[model samples]
Target: MDNLRRRHITSFQNGVLEPIVFDDKRKSMKSILLSSIKLQKTIAPVLSTIRNFYNKYYNTIHPLCFTFLSFLTRFYLISLSDVVMWDESHFGKFASHYLNREFYFDVHPPLGKMIVALAGWLAGYDGSFDFESATRYPEDLNYTFMRIFMASFGVLMVPLAYFTSIELGFSKHSTILVTLMVLFDTAYLCISRFILLDAMLLFFTLLTLFCMTKFHNQSYHPFSANWWKWLIMTGISIGCVSSVKWIGLFTTALVGLYTIEDLWNKLGDLSIPKIDYLKHWMARIICLIVLPILIYIGCFAIHFAILTHTGPGDEQMSSLFQAGLIGNDFAENPLEVAYGSRITLRNTGFGGGLLHSHVEEYPGGSGQQQVTCYHHEDFNNDWIVLKPREMEIYDNETDVEFVNDGDTIRLLHLATESNLHSHKIPAPLTRAHWEVSCYGNDTFGDEKDSWVIEVVDDVYKRTNHIRSLTTIMRLRHKVLGCYLRAANVGLPDWGFRQVEVTCDKRNNPKDTYTHWNIERHWNSKLPPGGKANYKSKFLREFWNLNVAMYYANNALVSDPDDNDILASKPRQWPILEVGLRLCSWTSDSIKFYLLGNPAVWWSGTASLMLFILTLFWYLVRRQRQYTDFSPGFLMDQFTASCSLKTKNMIFGIHYALIITIFWYFKDIAYGVSSPNIELKDKKWLSTWDIVD
Candidate 1:
């Protein structure tokens, strides 16, 4: 057991053992003592030398020595499996996208993937491999190098935890307890050995925590160079963690709340000068808010700069942004909105999309072809602009009529041959709004099918004449007096998850979602729009992209139709109620079980519970005015905080007993070319459902 301690101590050269010289009365004692004498002579010098070396160098090299051991634990047999595990498949593909100079979209922010791409580049990977789940890597892919580089981030995490404990005023043995918990956490070790973003995410998380505590310590010397440095570093770490994943926001929020409380305390200090207080507020605002924002934006800028090529993610962006991509030709759209011209209407909202319709009718409300806002363009997106009439066809002859502002026009779906119509029936998703749908053929339509155009183009000029790709306008339902809008209200399954389009009754002048722009107009009679007309500022595009990403992320829900073994509720994570199977379960494949060392995880949970109970106990006593903590009662307060360094040995004894538990489960992390039946003892924890 790793917890086993040495029971025997070496004797000093001048002490212990009677001399070898024996009399006849003690001849038998001579034989017994001779063997012991030879044993001491053989090993005593070596044990003394080791003890001297440890005593002399332990303090100086312990961190380095143990950190190296941590690395070994993570790196050992890391290459045993050449297959991508768990989220590595997803992240690895994103890395290849970067290496190939192609754009892609993900729910997370970009810095972690960008670093993974950098890792691939440094590893000499040429972006040729597709990382399919459970797929073995190719010989020349150099995944090992990338993994090693990524794991380097994880390696720093152990030391970060160690130093963070010291900064938090943990005693020597308490610090060892903290560091050892991190060191032996199977989840941390195994996760670090992969080409996944968690390694960086967790490293930055720990770094942020460490910097927060370190900065708190420097609060004693406000505005000092060290204080400012740590404060700024804390902000940078927050930015990095956030860039890795949205989960980082939890840590950022923790620091933010603490800072708020700190500032509030300082504000109430009557003796503090107003100027110094102002400086404190200004410093925190600049470092905590502005600095992190700059870092986050800088990372996105790098993301946009590197991904200039047209990609599958183009559909998620505005037509203007798509046009700016290297291989997209979306700018070659007609400039004028002539009658009979087929066009796509783009809602001007932050994350709005093209007006779309499908043949599926609403299950509720006015049963008609579903009208929705769709990010992707398709034939269903094409709507023919026509004069407000019941005409079956329009002639694109010499006598042409261009749709203008204040002109009432009927929109006919090119693919479905139905007129865009709105009625008083409440929209399925937005109950307060009118249902927008495609109803009736071109030959048969009512006044409800007609919409009045109100163009409000650019700042330089008022455009009464509608211009494609540049004019901003609103489509008002002629009879109902509601504006066509798309506010990212998702439709039901019958509507295929597209955003609901409704005729909003509210006449909010600044409701961008209610505004419409004619994009990708097609009329053989009109001139094509110039690419210059479609240019957009990076900030505008970035803002809209994030909005779209937020909406998309919000819409993500687990499928109720399928049983997902890998997915677990938040409650299950703390106690290891489920273990994520990282690869296919087979006799031949190398498998990784994503479970933590139960001893560490459970102890952490217990500590949190203990803290809550301790707080409750103190609060109850305070309420009753049991405040005479002169000497005897005062010691309990110190003990409650666990700040008494005098009892470290007791703490260490308990820590080692916990470590023995961790030692039993080490194989689940270190090597499992194939998990044998015996290791099902991994099911040692009642919560681990590893067999399936």
Candidate 2:
């Protein structure tokens, strides 16, 4: 290459790949050392030859060696602590629920817990142990076996980092540094040693990234079998990561970005056949988009199939769905809705809640009793389907009237005796809808309290008469014509933090938010619906369950009154602003703190900032018509790879630095095994809440 072209190429390398074999930083470092330490100049060429030979032969061996060492590092003294730590209290309990085959709900998907349950089963655990925080395990529990099983995932992350880097065209030396950085990460090691989902989450995240890069490298092969294999694997990995936690969607988005770039490049290739381009598009649609969704659904299918008994999470699901649980007796609820029937109305929308009213009044809306959606079982959720106050008032002698389409009725708040009422005031959350509240005594409700029940559909019975737990219906205000809706947004703290309920102004017949189903019927004049009478399709339940998971996750706002000492904002994360206390601080118990190796974390941050600064300089120079990079840094990819010795030294130094830092903090990751430690030594930062 010409002098000018090499300078332009070297300029870009100085910004990005400066640590690679072919940069001037190595020469400068060597010169500084030689002048200060009086090193012989002839040693340079010999050192270069050694690095060249090692790079050519040892690239494959390095990742395997590091992976073996990582396994040792991660699994060493893995069962040092018998007490539960951090999220293990929650997630370990979930794994036990899975082992017991009981249905439960969580804000996250079920795959991680299921995987942990498999490990527990293998360890001969009978799901009888309590995973209370900082509580010691019983002698019979094989918690050691379980911890080692989960730590293997963390160990594999070392080789994954290497393979991911190599697939992305990183140099062999850089790959070694990357592998060591992950291998000795104190935080990663500590998390994997416990019974938590984070280790599984990270393993799948790296797997997703590695699969994406492998697929990218195969872009040249288009529809070859290997290409197809990797594309499908990428989708499967994405599904795995997402199933571990919804945060995996960020990984999916990254893969999506790469797919878009690949397709765009293929689109611009004039020589490739248009049919072949279309094939590429169709393949991506099938493997990347459709395959991931199928995998996600498959996980839920497995989740539903195993958890067959009623659990704490039954209320988070629909009443009909809960009825299918082995222990739930609600399946025997009476089928038909009649006058004087007590029931809970469930909103039919995805992630919907039970129609509820409490004595607390809406501060900004109608000032009547607050009507909201309750996710839990509460007496306030119960309402009576009764005759409008003036029409056919409920009396012992009055003939029973089954509610049907077009029947005008009033829903009496069974706890408070207030009728469900709607008015012209704006809703608390959704401005486009009217406020729905309970008003007037059961004997005095007027036209505003009247609702015309319109049956939408029925699962088993197609009659116009409403049925409990099956008939889907909408409640249209008799006077204002607004449909009752369980708004997805939640009310503020003063309203008890329940989901907002409103009367939607639009006549959107397809709006499921406005749809309601009678649940937990208490009518005595009818026969039991029978468990055999109620059934649930997994697909419908799957979507509804996932939506409920999403809504529950979004509803988790930080409680203002909760002095969450262990939690830190994202801004405090990178610079080691705080470290979490993983277990109890009692003097007799062992302790663990989740803190990353400062050497790796701070350097990565510095590297990222340096890249941003260099890119800005290049852009500003280019706009001034500077010939410094006439043909641009695109040519840097073709620059020669030489001067290997300096890269080898840098890689060695970085690897050693990571390991040394980890050793210094080994007590924190491996647990402070001895009791009664000093507070100053444990607390590395002012923000850390570690106790003596």
Candidate 3:
């Protein structure tokens, strides 16, 4: 038994103690074995070191898992119902139209809407209906699906921003901060919820900027395959952005400017023999100018093809030529076309359109009076305060009973009475014993003495032949005045006078009357029945008065005295609508030209010029001095000054510019405006008010 116990102990020490042997051992023997053994020792420090190393490197979850968790968290935390807004409706409608094979004059580019439609189709939602009908799924589900799409983009932007920041040499923290800020911004959040183009624009523009920075930093030749590829990508990206909105021109402009500056800086660095200046110049031209121009043209070609494909009709080609002509015309003459009819006078040597008519014919006519004719208070004479007057009477015609006193009366008569006292007119035109009389009868009263109302002018005026004609001419010059005065005669009214003035034509500037002239003959008659005979005279006289006034006012105002005084007519709504449509069409054309061939043309030419200039300078100057021509002087300074802080600042600027571009152009591309509410609002505590 002791030998057996010894054998068991030996077996345990050797790690060969089988379960059966242990089970078969007696209780006393087991206790003795348990107490007799020292506790098994461990390499605690080595284990601790190993554990520390693992925690440092492998304890954190895998990036893929983290990303998945992030997406899940976003899905759970964000409320899809909170995404309700105008842009979403517009996007849904546009996508539906696209999916239904319906043609539409979409102002925005089709990429973002296409993506949304694709998502909807994959999710078993109909993309060929209006938002309310197409989004028939539960509101939360529909919105969540849309939000998830946008959120995916948002998350993508995080990595893009990081890589771009690194390419720009931004510090790690600044890059992270910019990404975080964008991630949490309420505007960004809300915008992302809808399938809008802004976020996409931001992404593209950032990518472009990054690529451009990389291109600039490279020391390789411009004609290298890699360089060409980068340039092509840059061009395509910029073109896409511009396709979304006209404002993308700003980005294009910036890129062009930077390229030119870079070329200029490199021009002074060329090493060439003075005798072989021409060869070097040719090389520089090909590198800087020709290559860039080719790239720019290639970019523009894509845009041109797209635009031409989408434009309405074959008129686009002719319109383009006309556009060029119009631009030249505008540069030559800056005047805008007159708005309305152009009157041309016949049988006059001065005949022209009314816009160019002589000012003497219709002086001082206000533009406002041409469109709407009405009686306005004569502010020139405060004593002539006259209210609008109307006379009404009942007339029964066959079966129709007409009530003159009712609100439905159609005929209206306007009257004004002028008080003529010896004190009102000049004393030379007034006499002591002259009398004025008026006569009129009511048609409804059988023309009896009781139906007639007689009026006598209490004031009188004595007039010589000259003065009487002068008064007649003045009175006839006012059309409405003459009409009212003619109606007032032979009626029960007061204030009538015949006045005259005496003056020689050469000496009297105010005496416009000529009694013997045929034009003034109609002005000599008395009122009421005489109105018909004076109609032409009244029109002529009033027109002359208006012409005189218009000139005088024009002189005082320092404005043109052309006959187009009344040319400022209200724009017709249809015409305005047509004009807007035309403008949009033309704008699209301009954008296509700018994005496609123009970019290539300009960039290539600029590069060629830069290269040529560099070669020329290199050949002309000997032993380049730092102050005079060294390109490396400024380059070294620039590189040295680009510390971490400066790089961060630059990255910040890049981020800001990219974001701003997105904000401005997104609406144009998406056909929607920003919303007016927060993305998430939690109101847990509130005061309640009850009204009875």
Candidate 4:
């Protein structure tokens, strides 16, 4: 009774009295509820005012404001310094090639370079800059215009993002949020403010997604001109995307999937006739599949037409292919091959380089002077072909002397005054075979250096002349009974870091490296067809280029020789775990880092996961509510008016995954346009003669 001091306290409500228990916990909870209500009331005015501000200015004026901000942020101080940053050396050189109409090979498609070239050309650039080693820009060069042009694409990304959000029916605030994320991203800013392909890539990617979403919204009005316009635009955007890099294929795939899903849903609609569904499928096949392919091939065609003259890409292409180029040597008349001919042999194997010899000695296995395969054209790569015991008897004037099978021969290196010889000495890199070295004196080489010509087939084995661009032959060493081969391994400095060549006993004529071709042959006599019969086929040459590009892509992705230091695995990209060194000045003077923004990248990753979870949650809830989770129903539900959050989530996840997978497959962030950094131990690119 004494402890219950407040037990008799009662509250009067509606003229009724009731006993009230004095509970500290209950009172505290009531106080918290009242404070929360009061706080909500107090903030209501501020929230309404903020909403009113957004409603008043966001739709009409905000886009322009965002564009202004993006332009200022990206373009301000863009010409901060004249020093080359990141991939400017590579891309700038490519652009110059375009302006000069110089043919160059790259693993990527040509649209991005073409755009850069167009920009530079419009800016009064004379196409004379080499972009060598981050050298200073020329005084007359309008370098700022080029930088500003590239930044303009980055500027466009902000509005593109904003428009994309709006097209997907997102709220004004949500659109602003998305725009701000892209505008403020440090990675996008850094990459876009330079003359690189990334900004263009991002622009196309965003444009593609926007067009795709617009197309999706018009699905109900299929066959409408507006629908076709969006679909066609999406296809064109895909071409632009792929023109930048092969990574764009991921986005293309997503669009394809979207089209398939749309068609599948249209097929299931009971009101739509089967013929209507067929028409829809046909339209997509034409617009999505065939149209994009044509655009892609068209880009290549334009690329080929613009770059008519030969340049640095000559070695990467086949000898026949190079001969067809306008300014190349073979452009005049195809040279014929004959016995005792001075020629260069290029192996069509994995590395696909020229047989070469230099003064440098082998460091690892045989202590002889190194014999290797180089890709570029060099005087050192020239060799004199001689048939043993016949070279002295035969003269260059002899009527098309044919060196047939079973003929003993020797290759004398013209530059080093040494015979291309092989003995029982094991190869340095490929130990299973004998070693090939520049051995014996020039003029009169050793008997041990002799080799027998072995044509792979019976037709060519019967005393047939080895013709250039016609016959494939192998050189079998008489002493070691082995065939000369390229080992696909780089040698030390002595060999100019080119792939090592060896003599292997295994005679797999199918092996590309062992099968040799006469790349360049000198003979006064003309072939049966004559020079007029020589013709270049565009389709065949294009196919060959495709093959070359495929091999180049494989080498970069796999890093088969483990030479690339900047190559990162796919898993490292999402967490912002690695950064590439764009450029360096000595050890500490200045450096540029190619790193993604931590905040933007991490948030994208988080958004991707959250979107996936939300999608699953929505699907599960739908399944539980309807208990009829049929494909048609689910498709219709998704195609219908989805919530803004759901729409954004889907697009965001798709966008993130597309980019992530693309970068994963490419392995390198800057594509082939970026200069590969050289380390003391590892070499990224095939070694070429350093031209002064």
Q: Which candidate gets the maximum lDDT versus the true structure?
A: 2
For residue 255, model 2's alpha carbon misses the true position, in angstroms, by: 1.0
- Candidate 2 C-alpha lDDT tens digits along 195-299: 888888999999999988888788788789889999999999998998889999999999889888878987898999999989988998998889988888889
| Ten-residue region with minimum lDDT total, candidate 4 | 683-692
lDDT of 4 by residue, 314-341 (tens): 7766666666567766533334455556
Query: Considering every candidate listed, which one attains the maximal TM-score?
Result: 1
Candidate 2 residue pairs in backbone clash = none
lDDT of 1 at 410: 91
Error of 4 at 596 (Å): 5.7
Residue 626, candidate 1: alpha-carbon lDDT? 79
Error of 3 at 544 (Å): 47
Which pairs clash (backbone N, Cα, C closer than 3 Å) in model 4?
349-513
TM-score of each: 0.84, 0.81, 0.35, 0.70
Each prediction's Cα lDDT score? 0.82, 0.83, 0.34, 0.73
Better of 1 and 2 by lDDT: 2
User: Which ranges of candidate 3 are over 4 A from the true structure?
Assistant: 1-79, 82-84, 132-146, 220-222, 272-692
Candidate ranking under TM-score, highest first, comes to 1, 2, 4, 3
Query: For residues 40-138, what per-residue lDDT tens digits would candidate 3 score against the true structure?
Result: 224566778878876675413323333453354334433323333445567666556545534333434445556666666665566544555223335
TM-score between candidate 1 and the true structure = 0.84
State which candidate, 2 or 4, has the greater TM-score.
2
Error of 2 at 143 (Å): 1.2
Whichever of 3 and 4 has more lDDT, that candidate is: 4
